[model samples]
Target: MNNPHQNARMTPLGRAEMVRRIVEEQRPVAEAAAGFGISRRTARKWLARWRAEGAVGP
Candidate 1:
């Protein structure tokens, strides 16, 4: 399986945007995680961070 985001480096802003797409845009976490080449657990982590601390969360 060739996944572009698998080894790609993303900026914090970029990661925030991805989180926005999932949260604000109502995108499915599993689908977004697959597109990002990350596990669903990671996607949830990001979402949790975003929810707890807005955009600049770690």
Candidate 2:
């Protein structure tokens, strides 16, 4: 079977870490975003989702 996350740049753990760095560590959105190799906008999207719905967002 083809694995969907095989070629993916980010995984579930990566997302959790990204959010953790931004929230728990209080890292700047831009800095954390860059560290994760994603754009600040994308980071904000996840941050917003994290704020709104948390890890189990739909």
Candidate 3:
């Protein structure tokens, strides 16, 4: 079977970077989420993780 996460196209590091761009560049959350092919809720969750813990994923 295909790896479901492969279709997601973003690694843990990539998720960090995406959040960084959204925060550092003042990019819109919705735009970044769309660009990363993830839901805005997911993006917001990651951003929250980053803000609270300074890291994302394992």
State which candidate has the highest lDDT: 2
- For each candidate, what is the lDDT? 0.74, 0.79, 0.78
Candidate 1 lowest-lDDT run of ten: 1-10
Top-down lDDT ranking: 2, 3, 1
Q: How would you encode candidate 2's per-residue C-alpha lDDT over 1-58 as one tens digit per residue?
A: 1233577667767877899998999999999999989989988987887788878431
For candidate 3, lDDT tens digit of each residue in 1-58?
1233655667777787789789899899999999889989989988887887776331
Q: Tell me the lDDT of model 1 at 35.
A: 78
In model 3, which runs have C-alpha deviations exceeding 4 angstroms?
1-9, 56-58
The TM-score ranking, best first, is 2, 3, 1
lDDT of 1 by residue, 11-44 (tens): 5666777787897889999987787777888788
**What's every prediction's RMSD, in angstroms?**
6.4, 3.8, 4.3
State each candidate's clash count. 0, 0, 0
> Which candidate, 1 or 2, would have the higher TM-score against the true structure?
2
Q: Lowest-scoring 10 consecutive residues by lDDT in candidate 3? A: 1-10
